[model samples]
Target chain A: MSESRIERGIGLLLSLIQYVTASGSVTVQEAAAHFGVPEQRIREAVERVFMAGVPDGAGDFIRFDIDFDAFEQQDVISVTMRPAFEDETVRLSPREASALIAGLTLVAGYTEAAPERVAALRDKLRSAASQGADTVAVDTLAVPLAAQRIRDAIRDRSVLAIDYRKPGAGTQRRRIAPVALNLNEGQVFVEAADLDKQGMRTFRLDRIEAIEPTHDAWPYALPERERTVTGSAQVVATRAAAAMLRDYATSEPVSVDGERVRLDIEVWSEPAVLRAVAACGGDAEIVAPASLRRAMHRFAVDALGGPSGEREQTPRD
Target chain B: MNRVEAEERQFSLLLALVDTSVGFTKHELFVRVAGYQGQPVGDALERMFERDKDALREHGIVIDVVQPPGDDSNQEARYRVLDGVLGSPAELQFDAEERDLLDLALRVWHEGGLTEESQRAALKLRADPEFRGGLPLERTPGRTSDPDGAEPATASILQPRQRPRESAFQALKRAADRRREVVFDYLKPGERTPRSRTVQPWAAVLFRGRWMLVGHDLGAEDTRTFLMQRIVSPVKDRAAKQPFEAPGDAATTALAKLEEIWATASVGVHALPGSDADIRLRHRRDTSEEDGLLVVHHADRHLIADELTGFGSDVAVAWPAEQRELVRQRLERIRDAHAEATGEAAS
Candidate 1:
């Protein structure tokens, strides 16, 4: 087998080994069938398993007797390898960690992956701080904290009392029946009764401040007209938000600071308290809303001008 | 390269990157190439871009320099490069089927949220070489039917293509290149603990989308499965005291086990008393079976408890065990603090 192919085969063997034990054995013949490899190739791969003890003192024998025939028939073989009673290995290479880190790193920014080349430059030297870091910060993306309570109170197929904050508008707190928790625009939205109107309206998670789940459960249809405004855009206040703002420090208006942009945003996030954080872009970008997030979408936007220069708006005439 | 040739070649690369189907604006194309050139700002270079575009077109290279939505007001029209016509006269356009698919996909994506990654992917698709046929439906039924030779493997700063096995090959290469016997931890399935093992590295490979390393464990005197992702703090570039040898186990391969790490990392948080049971959350909705239980997905029970504790006396953890006891204590403490302000806890 090619060196790379052998590596792949061995990796598969290790993954299978995770399921095997001193008392249990994964058969080679069955693995061959599953892998669509010859029995000998399967044996070569299985023999790569981490086990102790040797038959005839060679250590090359199936540390324990494995029933090859039974394995081929049943697709599982009994293991006889004696436990070595040693520690296991779990260290991944920088490259593998890089991939996983790239995937999960979005949990914080919640923004999707950036361009690959840019990601590589950013990923270089910036490994995930070990789980043993001095401090670990936390936050959420899909839902806000204040509304969390109200959302729970709604219960499934139940009536809800939402203390909602409107878009650059006032607060409306009322009890309403809820139909569903769905997402529109990658944002989680709730379809429930707009208590005053007695009609169903979709509330963004960010806009919900307080939720009271009543004991009553009922089913209702989502009003088709209100579907357009499905979910709310929420901003979270977190240490992660702060760290990201620091990263945003790079995109601060190039005109203002060599490395910074004038950060100001007007977002529709709610719960008054949660909106006050350092999220990026237009999500509660006030410098004072310490709890609010500062969001920046302008850089990524394909507009024609820098932070300065009035957008050449077409003459209304 | 002459102005015409340079522009033509640059557009060629750009077209290869983003298939003809997904067109790019002049600004997008310029920024992408500027990134390649380290932001060269000069009128001469800009002029070259125009000249080369025309030359490429004359050679039957259909490079459409398009000006996207945001008008720069240069009033000078711009175009984007697509397929190399090599002197053909037909302007390459999306056929009905390709147009339909693109429209539906774009609608779903736009409605979902203007996801930046999706947009980038779409933009890149426009210049990709794989977009040979007029539209995907014309030849094949499957969506995104780019012929094998035309597929564009995009790698950008924000979006890197870490295909399966790439990591494994890299790790194994590093190990072999350095000749090191490394030690690391492996989290197995149905188990709570991650154990450490010493390994003599032989090779690594990417099977699907993850890395797998095949190495001989010193403790086991045999080979084992090592999931590339599950490995932590790998100390690379060390020498192996012993030589390499093939293992003789008659069971699963090491590579498969490495791939199983995620599904196998059976981890449960050490539940503090408050996090032990289902907690009833009060939303402004009616109660249902699904909404009744509050699942604290956190691996840190205390952290979950702390969050629950924030609700003060309003929430309670139900059943499983008297899980609310911890929260109750917290509430009592808060209540006492308030009472001290008003002398209630003492009462």
Candidate 2:
């Protein structure tokens, strides 16, 4: 076909062969799925390998011995006789190496283990790929002391008492069975079973002013299904706010009709929903759920110190 | 040539180039490689050979062009793949624990643009006999074996928005890695026009949900952080007449500088006690209540306003007249929109 297609085909074949050689035996279906290609393409590539060899070779020609019976009956590709270079490891392309290096560097930043071990591993990967170590950099979010302590409690499976600052509620002592730690965007969240609330709750790590491991052991097993601290909200807004909505919304807008765009958003809390709506200024309104609408009206009236007509503007110098 | 023939030729060419220690000259390669065989020695063969070399290089195979030790002429350049460059080192091996750790580390890229590379690396590691028997790697969080309808709860669930053009990021990353300067037209957050800048890129960092290029702006004579999203023009590599070493903690320093900017710019808001607005704003780091007003530190006033607007009547911008006016305007608009929608519904 076209030149670049042929080039890509060869690259895919080379990578597939490398993978098969390393893994010993991989099914044709597995190969197809892993490389995100059609099964027929993988089969054709394998068939081509039988005809490919050194030009002047007598008995040492390169060949892949496929199990014909298994292939015909069960769609299994068992390479009976591996290629001569099967022992040779597949070399990474410079772009591939660079991408991996960048990824590893980012991982190193987030890792909580010994700094030296991560540093050594990063150096090894760089040297092996013939790439410089400092090519890619990442600055991980600084984990607070309280967050670190909470992490320790998670690993130890202990009950933790934290001086958590819940929005509007002020600081309060919370005892929770620390389950897991999650990082979303740049913020860290701790998923735990609030012993007092007796339900799953997510605490933003930064909001935890103080945390201590209670000597008591974990009282319950982690739930089979991890509860996500996110909910979807729909809103209609002006073009400017809609533009901002596109930025903050987790996904694309559900629908857009002129300046009013309907967006389905996943936010951490009900307050987060209110915060997002407020961020839009007054250009946006939550159109669905009559209950939420009433709440918004109340929230607005309260902030204004009365109804819209009589509300006084508390201007500050 | 057909697909099989083209690949066979390339494969034969690789075998020839890699087999020889001294490397093969142009004439020797044409005679030895299978694809070049049977073809008449002419421009056609030369063109095909050139294309093959490019294809191989694109796959990260480095073919070294070397002159025979005794010969001192530019002509008759010989080529060979360098030793160990394409092959794994014999001494390099990983135990079960290290392999597991690597498998875990590679998982971080599940939502990133580097999935293909990470997958290839994982396959490469799995190929080794020692690592073959290790525990099966855990699937990405959302794809786990948990019962259906169990919402995948990842702490860091928000993936960075995919950039419109990744080439800018790739170019900036390369320049930073090579210690080279780059020139590009940048649009500041609120500015209407773009400005050209020349800087020695120190580090490319992901901060506050965006990729930022931090570097020494030669014109401003100060370190500046440029948002990748706001880079209006393609990043062009500058001539490397002089290169400066990146500080050992370049990334950390750049992030600290961003934090400093946020710390210096503060805003004040009055939220009714026990309201969602008051609770959420108070929970934010570096925010405190002073005389019934919530004092918030932020990098972008517009961003803070966006947050405050979501609270409706529960919160009011207490200071920074510009931000207060912004919130006021937004609230009025929302109020007007709501009244219109309700009026239509009632009718």
Candidate 3:
């Protein structure tokens, strides 16, 4: 797990103050007594000692000083970290990280586990990420597909024309009024009332060739207040494209100020509104109205450095 | 690992071993426990094997049946923990013998002394039942080192290198706990060894699996890592010394350079290593990783770099600029080293 700045700071303080080379430096019982913690807790606290040090001032190693020749003795840590094993690291521990990665690779070369724990593992990964622990890229055939769009449509009771392919059908075809999408294995299965079947059927999205609005809309409209938001991927894609262009902006959504999506994100581009617009990936309009867009166009022209210079043609959809 | 004692402590040890393994197979149970029985004991072993599961289950340990392979006909009966029971925690129930092991671990972590089978015996606790509230090790056991009843003879332990006397280790520990910078009247090991040198203590460590005292040698005006075993004599300094502080963990930032810890860097940029993504981080020696991380370090750089190449997308770069550069350079060198190492440009 990644450490928080405070946790690391505390560790730094402890390392500086309490990392004694005393023979009884860290006894679980003693630590528990001194810290007023349980055995489980103290062990957890003590395990941090394993990751307690930034090795060699470069912050490369999560090192613990041990008194054994790793090459000679096969301690648990040493065995797992035996110069040959490699695993994807979640945080900074090379042995565990490499061991895990190596293990997954070894496992991947063989079998697939039942589909479960995606969210839990992802949550663990997210927690580790929060603590600044980088997760090893684990390749699994069991991760659930992103079903945000389907979820939103379902939540809103909006009509969806899904291009779906049935297993062994050998091809994809269109359908109407999808209720939701559920993930089974790595692919998404759309749950919709099929007109032909007049019943609920699951269609794999990957098997689908396309998606479009049918000539018909929803049987009943969703109230505006009940609509859900889903655009992280889209926003991220936009930011990545901006970064590719060497100009970028990042924003945190502010109050949904009326119909406008007010954002208090940091901006660096001169045409601030355009950069903001670009960051939003067209989901955002210049709700501040003429002033925001006009200033952006002017800045775009200014960036081009002349009124007729024609650099204003920024590729925005 | 003995026969007579194994029979005497068989029930307790077996129960304990069950707690340790979380679960054990019948074959494994036979090999470990019956292997301890020794000599023409196969008949008795067969009896124990049949009754072993029932006996262990009586002691709140269950041998779980693992899932059979889809294609296999003969089901491999695997053992595991019973539901709602994670067995024991180590600190909870270490007996005197196990406590002795903990004591040894404590001493070495403290005094920097190594002894015969201490690491081995202590390692055994890993195979013991997780004890409940064994003993608090935070406070000193009152400056009194317990006498191990079954101490192995020194002759049994080959001297791999130099070993500091027990007295010296105890002294260093006492001084360090008091937060006093110790003046080592250190006698260096090997030919033409010097008798003594004064130094300001920063931290004492077990490194490369040997005790080392890190201190600023005032005369030399430099920090040095001194192996404890190499010191023939070490005395607390006469001069008033400042409190010794271990170097911030940043010292181990070099751990990423170790071969075994390289898989954490196995990421390829486009999120193509299946579903999980990888990122590179440089955790300095002081950067602590809590969530079940494994780290390794070696004096060899190339070995680590070479090992890092296989992680592919599962690993990330998380460290020293030079190490990252070395990884980058090593990837470049892969072109020249192995023919099959076709260039795979990863972002």
Candidate 4:
């Protein structure tokens, strides 16, 4: 077996022993599923465990009691005789601690609680791991108050009256039953049933100018069919820009043809797509969907005073 | 040796190490450890012992080697797995709610390279009775009603992509954590070749879906943020050098400096009053409507340009000649590609 597999198997063994001891007994199938391993692998790991012991000692070996009936018929794991040293505290490896620390720092960014509370929790985790106290540098993408209000409405099954700023269309007041808040690629989106439009739509949280929770409760159950907006765009970019796109793109690229990378993405709104293209500078261009391509040309022409140098009447005109 | 035998040997070695308090010499370990026993004491045994030590250490097992207290000669050292370093504290406890929160925190790495470590940690915690009574594996909770549900919404937001195992990110993180100096070849934006840089890493920060390492350059005598992806070569640690102290608020300071740089670069554009571009730009912080054009201030002009291009004809860039040119070129590229495709169809 590869070294990594063995290492992972060891970690699994340690965790399994601890789990079986604490939970009294667990089925082999459940253990396999929980550890994301095949049942046969778990069985092999367990069989190996039965052979482990101190050298040249008659009674100094680790022991386990397995029910033969459950093993043969039901595939249940009953550890009647637990390891003597099961109560030993397991310390996290340095790598494990670092991974957790990085993860917690990321979580602190999305948390709605006070910064101090999150910091304290992080400190506690560091102390538990016996690591030095250097504060992690995290870009706390603070959720807007409007987004928070929408989240609360989703939880309470209430309707939200929001002054939403839709791209190309300006601010409009609408009442909608907020269903779910999705976080895709560091952006927050609210999937709601638009009362006026009478269909499902997604609104970028940052574009929500103002939101007020109404007393009216949601009258309908969540729609069974998820409203997913998926599209693909092809673009040619510089190597540097391509790397950035690979990192920030919603999903993996569909194909890479020299400098051009075609991306299959789930877009929340049309403006979001424009925002992505804008971020790429001149390095990336959308190659498909004639409407989107024309939109790009128009956006450029409009920004440059309509291919004529004459000042446009308005930013959108 | 067979895979099972290798595992059995490792497990036996672990048991032997954990069972002892006084420590063991190489000779004693060869006899006491199940796998090493009955083997001839020679070059083969020594090599096997050395490899086993490294394998165990890689799994986060702490083994300590120290000379006997009264020993004068440089003889064989006694080795022991450090006590209390491999296990959780007995007094450390987590309530169900705290466990749920931890579950949420751990779930953030579901898509990243840290998923395995996070999963193991979660399983370790779940072994405790206090945290075991919660729901079985479920997806992140969509609403607050099921806070302890499968997946937390926050975790889904800002999904971190899995980084390469040998990425510069891991190296920089290690250096920052150890307060060590690192040297690497870095490629700045628009630069073709990479230049070597010696820096004292302070922190690794993620902003706008990209990882940046904040560090103090020794040669330049200035603090800078190096994009992780732009790092072209392996990050090498300077050995046998005194580590420098990281500034207390290094991360915050670096982020603020980046934000400051962005604030100074503004682009002027024209959009309809209620158009999507106008609404979104107006909603953005540090943006204002000036005269007949809206001036948008951003940290990264390229990123802003990409976003603006999506608006398509709905907005116009009025100022910042370079940004306007970038948009024009991008539009031209798209138009040319479409024309070529259409021409082929007509032919």
Candidate 5:
């Protein structure tokens, strides 16, 4: 049997018992949502598991003595006679402790939270861990220097003129009304209203060349739309490249051989896919959408030089 | 046993053990415990008891074993839960502000391997009476401009919103915890082919938003740190001749080495003022300007090379002939791969 399931089950039961004991009385629905479990599982746990107890030496068992009457009719659970134990608060398993500690370590590097307080909290967590808290290490990227100024712009709701880098295109100057900063997939992005394009644009935080503060306030009141419009293309990827593309594959393998397989992948940006293909270093090829294939060639040619560069050669196929 | 029965058995066993003044022997437990009762006395029953002990220990319940004096063969032994072993102290408390910080940190792990771990930890914390009545963290006012009330810009800017994990992360972590050897295909930077590596995983460290596994590489017979993203194939556990013992401080050692590399490694680049590379590299942490060139500090050469390659003609590597060669090779491979067009017009 998978031990994780058993661990999860036991942890759930103990936590549920503690929650009900502490809350005095809680609805089954609320408990279900709180634990992210199904209502049926909660009912089963309460009705069949916690209602009973272990056997004592004197031919009698110590029962939890739950108020099953209220539970049956009102969807509420209450533990009347608690189990006979001192200090029954749940202790975190090693995995659990490591997760929290690692997360705290990362947050400490960039957050405005006081360093002393965070350190104290880490100590507290270390003490609470059953064992082996020190085995999991975490390090986070320091907040970029541009991040603080960007936060200030978002807070002030001010229009800022900035130079932003577009992949395959040189730096372009634009005025944007700053909104929120989003961190996704280890990269930071700023959601803003682009005045030049009259649309919302998400700019990579690292790609901003310079921020020129403007006194003008944000003028548009546009609601945020779907952040990305995914586009799909078919490609033949080597086993190595296929592994990287697995996350973006939209359909089952169109066909598979020993070495290469055809996959239909969906991506938010065509240029990003081109870059990924370029990173693969010829392990992947665009098999469909003639325009995209041509675009792939053009993307690489431009990266090397222009159409008139000395390296430009004839087609391979 | 099924899940429900197993859970009930463990809980009852824990309760029985904690309630006892003197621990119960294996035979006594099998005869008395509700779930263990009525089982025939045999090797299977003994294995079940041992497995139960392991499961309880995995859940952080420390079961103390009392043995007869000098009984090396374990002919007579009893098991019971030590006092105060099941939960943290009642006084292990957190203030409102501290809880708020913890809440934000815990919330950052979503849809990742650590998500469940964080949730389980949060549940344990919430079970404390001191934490009662703190159901939802209050949002700071005036920062709720998002229509859906997304996280405020301040919090988002200060922390990572995603873990950026690889497919082999969970497998590697489990293999490390179990002290098992794992085999996977790894593609190192600047290398076209992937190589199979067999290693005894020691610990996994999250450095710079990437999961890196620190382990003893069998082929190299030395401790090596591998970035998880470079693992190109599924991680498979290979039974070792004997379970390897991990160094207790493996994580700290790996982190110290990474920091050392980050401090010592330097690369020089030339970027035009107000250019993309200029802005990106200038604001990078630990970056400095020397001789009218940007000195970018990096932990790994190939990773930084990948970033510089993205800049195209806007930036050029100035020093460190090896790094310059790496970037040059990558650019050339990209160019060579597409140099031959398939009879198509430039789109």
Candidate 6:
């Protein structure tokens, strides 16, 4: 085996030895499961490796005293004597501590997890870690109430009256039976059954203006989600815009010209495609499907025209 | 001479080190340790010893070296494991609750970047004498509900995961830990070209859902932050220069700077009531309503513009002439991209 690979195994082996020594006796099967290793590796590790200690006078050797009979017959490993390395504490390297601590900090930030307990746990990890673990940090945002409420509604199977705003439309009250929730790139999306629309729609949690539980329960058995691809469109993209389009593309993008790519994309909704095109900001254009291009033109024109109807525009702040 | 397995050799060396009181000289170790006993004592043997010592150091074990006075040329030295260099592991103990929290933390990064570190840490923690008895902590009530009825690895039902490990993140983090400077090509948003930056990385922070490297830009001669996503080239270590010490409070300082920017960069928008813009912006953290206008503060102006552009005709930029112009330009581009005869309409 390579030197580094063996070194990594040494860490595992050392930890395993310490565990065995501390526990006094454990089944090989139990040891294998605990370490997430197969039973054969565990048996080999004990029998072939870590069985020897320092050589003594006259070419003799001092070795760890294991119960050979019990180990061979009953698949049990009992370390009777450890000639050296007596300590049994689990030591975390600096990087190990950092990874764990960074993860804990992220969780503690987003949820109302017990603050005192997290703090106490963090301090313990810091104390246990080697030097240089504290250099990594993660920023936390406030707990989003909308996400919390939606999660509760999903669990209760309760019907909800939510005022949801589509991309270009005003908030419309809809009775929804929310099911699964997904988070991508810090945005929360909920898949729900829209009673009025009679189909499932994915609603951005942030776009939900207000959500209240209805007295009625979810009316039917849970339904499988609708197919994601309702339509397809072709677009020409500049290099920069291609990078952004790659994220939303349902299929592989093919290079068309120098610094440009042709992408055949699945369109989940008209509004979604328009927003993506707008985000690209002219670097990408809808090449075919004349209707989408027309919609894109109208989308921008209406946006530039500003708010219509009752509320008169306030002067620019 | 038979080649001994690396593990047995290392283990024997460790046992010898831990057993000796005064320590062993280089020649004595080669002549005595099981792995090197039959090998010829020479440069190759010495190099092998050095490599083993370095490997042990990676495991956080430091061997104490005792040198003879006035023997610099002779290279007379002795080595042994010290009492506490390997840490007083026997004294380390975690209660049941802490163990559960540790397990939860370890499971956060499933299989990338930090997974190896977290897994090794888990193995080490399982060695703790108290680890055997504790059942994994139960999920806290009310807030703990997984929508799919899948068992969550963490205590919280809301598993907001870290973004997939950034390509440049591990390099920058390793540099920060070792205090090494790194060089990479950074592509700033809206720029057509990338510029090479040599920076002394100090901290890696996850700020506002993005991985950012906070470091001192050697070229700019100032502390700067670079978004990891914008790094267009592989990060390579500048090995000629010696490593330098980083400030103890690098993370705290970087976070404070980001927070300050987020507090000051405010934009105003007029959204039709009950529209996507109105609802999302109003619910956004740190938003204020003034004269029926939604005022939002963010660290990046382009990000705000991009979000507003996504709302299409439902929202309009209301203030800060520069930001308003930026939104207007984006909208015009979108409109012109689909205007059919694009040349004259684009200009």
Candidate 3 or 5, higher TM-score? 5
| DockQ each | 0.02, 0.24, 0.02, 0.33, 0.32, 0.40
- Where does candidate 6 chain A have its weakest 10-residue lDDT segment? A1-10
lDDT by residue for model 4 over B1-347, one digit each (tens)?
Answer: 42336666777777777767877777778777767777888998889887777666645676788797788563477888876465553423565444545655665555554555565565555455454311223322223344334443443332333344226876776566556799998767544456889999886666655677787888798998887777756789865265588776776687777777767988888875566666677766668877878888876665566566666666678777777766666656544544433222111
What CAPRI-style quality would you assign to candidate 6? acceptable
Compute the lDDT of residue B36 as modeled in candidate 3.
Answer: 33
Reference-based TM-score of each model: 0.26, 0.62, 0.20, 0.72, 0.83, 0.79
Q: lDDT per residue, candidate 3, A64-167, as tens digits?
A: 44333531243211212211001111121211222222122212211122224323332332232212112112222222222445554554445566655332
Evaluated against the true structure, the overall lDDT of model 1 is 0.35
Pick out the ten consecutive residues of candidate 6 chain B with the lowest summed lDDT: B133-142
Any idea what lDDT model 5 has? 0.69
In terms of docking quality, model 1 is: incorrect
Per-candidate clashes come to 132, 23, 100, 40, 0, 1
DockQ of 2: 0.24
Consecutive 10-residue window with the lowest summed lDDT within model 2 chain B: B153-162
Of the candidates numbered 3 and 4, which has the greater lDDT value?
4
DockQ of 6: 0.40
Query: Candidate 4 versus the native: TM-score?
Result: 0.72
Chain A TM-score per candidate? 0.36, 0.63, 0.25, 0.72, 0.77, 0.71
> What local lDDT does model 6 show for residue A238?
61
lDDT of each: 0.35, 0.60, 0.34, 0.62, 0.69, 0.70
Per-residue CA lDDT of candidate 4, range A14-61, in tens? 666676666676788776655556678778777666566544344356
Better of 2 and 4 by DockQ: 4
| Distance from true location, Cα of A111 in model 5, Å | 4.1
lDDT string, candidate 1, A197-289, tens digits: 756776666456566666543434433444332223222212212222332232322223221223332333332222232112121123323
Q: Rank the candidates by lDDT, best first.
A: 6, 5, 4, 2, 1, 3
Candidate 2 lDDT tens digits, A133-163: 2333454444456666765565556798988
lDDT of 6 by residue, B1-347 (tens): 77887767777777677777788887777766778888987888889898788666656566788888877754568888754445556535677666656655665554435655665666677666455321122312122344555543334334334544467777776677556789998766555456899999887777776678888899998998887766756899866275677787787789888899999998888877776667778888799998778889988877677678877877877788778877788788878778883322121
